[model samples]
Every structure is written in structure tokens, then in C-alpha cells.
Target: MTKVRTINNYTGIDTRSAIGTVDHPLANMDHAPTISELCKVFLKDGVALAVNASRKALHEAQLSPLDITHVVSTTCTNSANPGFDHFVCKELGITQPVEKVLLHGIGCSGGLASLRTAANLALGSSFRKRRARALVIALEISSLLVRSELDSINDSQDTRIGVTLFSDCASAAILCNGFGGVEAEPVYELLGWDNRVIADTEHDLGFDVDPLGWKVVLSPRVPKLTSAAVSPTFNKLLQSLPKLPPHYKTASDFDWALHPGGATILSGVEKAMNITPEHMRASYDTYINHGNSSSATIFSVMDRLRQKDMDKLAPDGKAKDFVVGCAFGPGIVIEMCMLKRNMSHIQRTLVVESGEATPSHTESERSEGEAGQEIEIQIEMGSMEGKDEELGEKLRDMHPEVPQQGDSLSEALNGVELD
Candidate 1:
């Protein structure tokens, strides 16, 4: 049943390299991959990435084997019977009697959607029971399906542009009522959740089944449309908040966890919210380094951003920083969450029940040393008046180790002059 022959982490990003790779068998043949091949790629990419991510989360949470009570997964790439959850359970060795839910066709918005579901299911408890935990994971392997058979201009710049925006990645999180460690970092408190499907724009974005494989139904009007509409939707979410934090009147108050769907998408959301690179640095970095990894992209974004302006619980059981996580998908849907930095896991857990926990995901690790090395550059807002290349160049000079846009695996490494 093992479809993967090997693992070669060709992509520059180390985290994504852990996931397996796929090949377009028909690229050179100028034909479609047999449906069997497509299915095989889908299963392999989804299952492998899911298992790797789950294992990482388990290790980080220090969870014992067979301890997870439920597994929630989302994917729009490929699917089959016995599904990804079944594979994850067997591979991760979760005990029987575990609940399973698979969300399909949700597209990029599915990650936060799955997180919202997990949080709702795990509500009402501030302490973990042996059987009361949920693991949420998202896999988007759309990069594996690029075949010239489907595009009118094979390997053309525009056709290949999608690969630069969509990538293959998987990310997971362990949601419990509470964790024992207040100092154990990287636990994201589920503060608030919101979602909306934009009316009359259903066809604007979607995935459609086609002969070659899944056809991407993306419209060029996406950036402008989303820019104009998303802010209102975000405002609606804030209005639905049970209780607003002090002086938190606009989107500027919360750091954004945008999907990094594309450069335009990221910039569009940034412009609409009146935020800047510092506010959405993770989103920009994810796009430049990881491409748009669909639903899994935000997990990477949050992970990279774990320690930025974060802190532990105050004596009063609230956090200083807050974040709003969001993703857009085919239904023209917007998946959103309001997260705050937690001072203590158990303390915040109690506050969550009382609707007063404000927190962010602060990974329990030394904030200094290696963790601080990857910190983002702090630039003043509206300082980005240069062209795209100029901005990219400035970012590159700040971190010369970061590979440039046209960097191939070898080229990216070529600049790594050894000591």
C-alpha cells in the first residue's frame, strides 16, 4: 500500500521538505494521468503529509499514543475510500473508538473551518480528559496535479504561475480543554471564530473535476473583489463578538493570519484592513518561501509567527496580543478566528469558558537564542513605496540567507558560502 518510493526534500523550506513529493507522470507525454495515477498521488500526498504533521504535533504536545479522541482533516486535492483519517489513525496508532471527520471541497478556507469545529466540539472543559481531545489537520497537494494536458499553453509563464501560488503542505494542531503546562509554549487559545459565504460570487473561486484532473476555477477579478468585500465581512465578524476588547475598534488591533493565497490576495487584504508588512509579515513570508499552501498555509504562518510580540498569562488570565486568522475558498467563503496570546493554558482555559480569554499561540520554547534568530524585520507602516522587486530586494538584503524568487534548489544553495 506504500506508494512513495522515497523522500527528497527539494523545496528550500525545511518544514515543507518533510512532506513527500509527487510527479506529473503525463507532463512529457502530453496526456492526462490515468485516473488511478491521480488517485494514487492524492492519497500519497494527503496521507503522508498528514501523518508527518500529526506526529510533530503529538511530539510537541507530548501526548501518549492512542490518546487522541477525534481527528478532523480537510483536503481538496485527492480523495478515496477508507479516506485520510483512516490512514492517519493507523499510521499514528490512535486507539479505536476515536471519532473521525473529513472535510472535502472546502478549499483554502477549510483549515480554520476545521479548527472552529474542533473548538466547538471541545468546548465546556478547562481540563483534559483521557478521551477528550481533537487533532485538526489540513492537506493541500494541488501542486502535484499540474499537467500541460489541461492548459491551452503548456508550460507558459501564466499557466505555470499557479504553481508559484499553490503548493503542497500539511499542518496540524492539538485542541484540548486545557493543557497542564502554562509555560509549555505554542498552544493557541481559541478565542473567537467567524465564517461567511459571499453572495453572488460562488463561481468566482472553486475546484472543478475535469478530464486531466481537478481544474482550478480562479478568476482574475479575485483580488479587487476580495479587497472591496472582505473588510465588511470582517467587520461583521467583529460585530458578532460576544464582548469586544478595550479600544479594539478596527482590524488594525489584531494581527492578521491571512491565507497568503497570492501576493495580490495578501496585499489586497492588507490594504483593505489598513495594515502593513509588519502586521502580515508571516503571510508575506509564507507566500515568498512556501507559495500558497492552501489551507495548510496558515499553520505554517502561525508557526513561523509563534513568538512575535507574544507573552504568557497575566495574573488576571488574559493575553496582551490578539490575532484574527482567516482564509478564503470557493464558496467565496471566509473562514476566520479571533486568537489572543495566553498567559497560562489552564488559566486561559477557564477564561475561555467565561468568554474572557484573550490569547495567541505562543510555542513553549526559549524566546531568545535560536528562536529569536528568525525574527521578522520591523519596518514602519507605509514605508513600502517602492516597486515589487524593490520591496523583495529589501527583504532579501535583510536576510541574505533567504533564497531569491528564481532560486532553484541548487541555485538557492549556491549562495550558501560555507565557513
Candidate 2:
């Protein structure tokens, strides 16, 4: 029998403070700083974020420093000597000789690309006996490099959209062969991973790095080109999957966890994929609140889904086949992952492997609603500050198990309980 693999745990950090944003002290600065200055801010924020997220992941997963054998550090916004990987290990007191992989140069999609690479390493590497684990972190401090309005010399309005749409954040995901006792959902086997280059679109997006830091090169045409390519590329991905639902519409068929590349890109993708605008509210929420945290943006969406699922488990649940994630990287590539919700699976509510009981779920009941009303509402409770604990508790109280949460799909799955 083939062994199964699952993500043991996930942890994240938002590092927007060390940079200049609308709220940062330097936000009102007159000119874009030199590349070196950009580097300084980026490195500082990146290192701090990497360290924090690493600690959180290990703590939540309840894994010691030595438990991690490989480290994959991903960032498109920053790089340095004793790079993020080294800095993170050092800061976290992780003595394990972490093999490093820096995923820079690629744009937003790089996060998923890193995920694919890390997954391959976990599945194919000879680490099973050693119980070696791979930790992948996607960190982006986009706001740091954003151009200032006062500094705008001869730039077009479209040029600023990139900076406006991006926010800062870091997300850590782990792929373990078999950690002694890590509880997670079923092994969502890695289907086929593929990539394609949109010829002539290279001019659409990239960075010009020098002494002045990364000067973003974003084209207004990005949305149009992306919209054109989505249909074909998504179709190719579906054909590669061994099993696809008959009800599948197109690549844009389900609820999406997309990189908040910007409102424009999101609009383009929805049109290209033929998905309803409402299907992408999660992505929009991330954009509005977090901006564009590069590779880590998708995780924000995943975190939302995880929280929602945990908060809404029905006493008698149904299945979920409604979520998918995608991002855009270098070569203007799109990285995609599909999630299928299974109700029978048993999963913990909010306690991470780090053993911090953020929240725990119990059974709860609500009255059946009238027709045309969507009872299941996934709110980003903690996206704002000072509400993490309360939001977590809310999730646990409502969704305790997969089966019960799944019951939201059917009227017959309800039980009686008064408020």
C-alpha cells in the first residue's frame, strides 16, 4: 500500500510595518529611495517575518528545530546574503542544517511554484526513514518597494496600480512524510503540476533591480493577456487530472483563492475563467485588507477557508468540492491547487501543533433559513487587528467537525438547539 502525505501544519506572519506604506512614517516621503535603501528595509522586514513565521510554525506543529531538515524560503520582493533562510534559522535557534532554496525573481505565482517544488522534495526525496520534514515559507513585503505619489516624476496612472494593490504578509506551510502525530485532512494528492509561458507577455511584468532596489515593471495590458490565457491553461490543467467533476464549468468553475494581483487582474481572471464575481470575494478581501503580500497571498485565502470550515461544521455535515487556489509568477505563469471538502474526516478546530489552543469547536445549532438566503457566511474576523482570539473562538464554536459542517449544504442535516 502506498503511504499518504499531508501538510502537518501552517503558520503565518504579516510584515508590513518595516516598510513605507500609507500608514508608515515614510509614507509621506517625497521620493522613492535608492535601491540600496529599499534593500535595507526589505531585508530587515523579510528576516523578521521569516523568523517569526518559522517559530510559529514549529511551535504550532509542536516540532523541535531539529525536526525540520529542509527549508524552502520564497520571496519575490527581497533577497540577501545570510539570506532569509539562514537568518530565520539563526533567529529561531534552529540548529538543524537547513538546506536553503530562495524563490525570488518570480512574481506572485512563485508561492505556488515553491509549494510544487517543496511537495516534490517531500514526496520524492529519501527522507521517509529519517522522518525529514520540509518547511516552505512565502514572504513578501510589497509595501516596502511601493513608489510614492510625491515621487512620481513622469509615471502614468496605471504604473501605480501594482503598488496600490499589493500588501505585505508571510505564510508558512509544511509538507511532512510522517511526523509522529500530526492531524490533518486527507492527503490531497498532488495532481499534475505544469507551467506555460505566455509568449510576448514578458514585457507585461517584472522587476528592474539595481542600486535603487526593485523597480516594478507592471503593464496595463496584464489583465487582458491574463484573461486570454486563463481559459486554455486551465483547460490543460483539468485534462491532466485523472478525475474531474462532470459539473465543472471551466478553470473558473469554483470558489477561488487567487493572488490579489490587483482588482484588475482579479477582474480579468474571473472573466477569462467565466467565474462569477462573487466567487472571488475572498481574493478581493485579501487585496483590500492585506494588499499584495506576494507568494503568501494565497495562504491568506487558505487560512480563511480553513477557519470557515472549522467554524461551520454541521452536526451532520455534507461534502465540499468548491475551493481552488491559483497565483501568477514569473514567465507570467499561473500556479494552481484544488481543494475538495470531505465531511467524514476528523480534524482539530484551532489548536495548532504548537499546542496553542487558539480555539476548539463544539456542536451548535441555528434555525433553518428561508429560501435564497445563504446561511453559511465566511467572515474574515481577524483580518483586522485586536480580534484574533475572538475570531478563532467564533470559528471553533460553530464548526467542530467536517461532517457536521458539511450539513450546511442540506436542510435535512439540522438538529434543534436554542440560542
Q: Write down the lDDT of every candidate, Cα atoms only.
A: 0.57, 0.53
Tens-place lDDT digits, model 1, residues 10-69: 212222321334444544455656556767766765676677667666555545435566
Stretches of candidate 1 above 4 Å error? 1-30, 124-131, 148-151, 155-161, 179-186, 242-244, 307-320, 343-419
Best by lDDT: 1
Top TM-score hit = 1
Q: Count the clashes in each prediction.
A: 11, 27
* TM-score on alpha carbons, each prediction: 0.71, 0.70
Whole-structure CA lDDT of model 1: 0.57
Residue 107 CA displacement from its true place in model 1, Å: 0.4
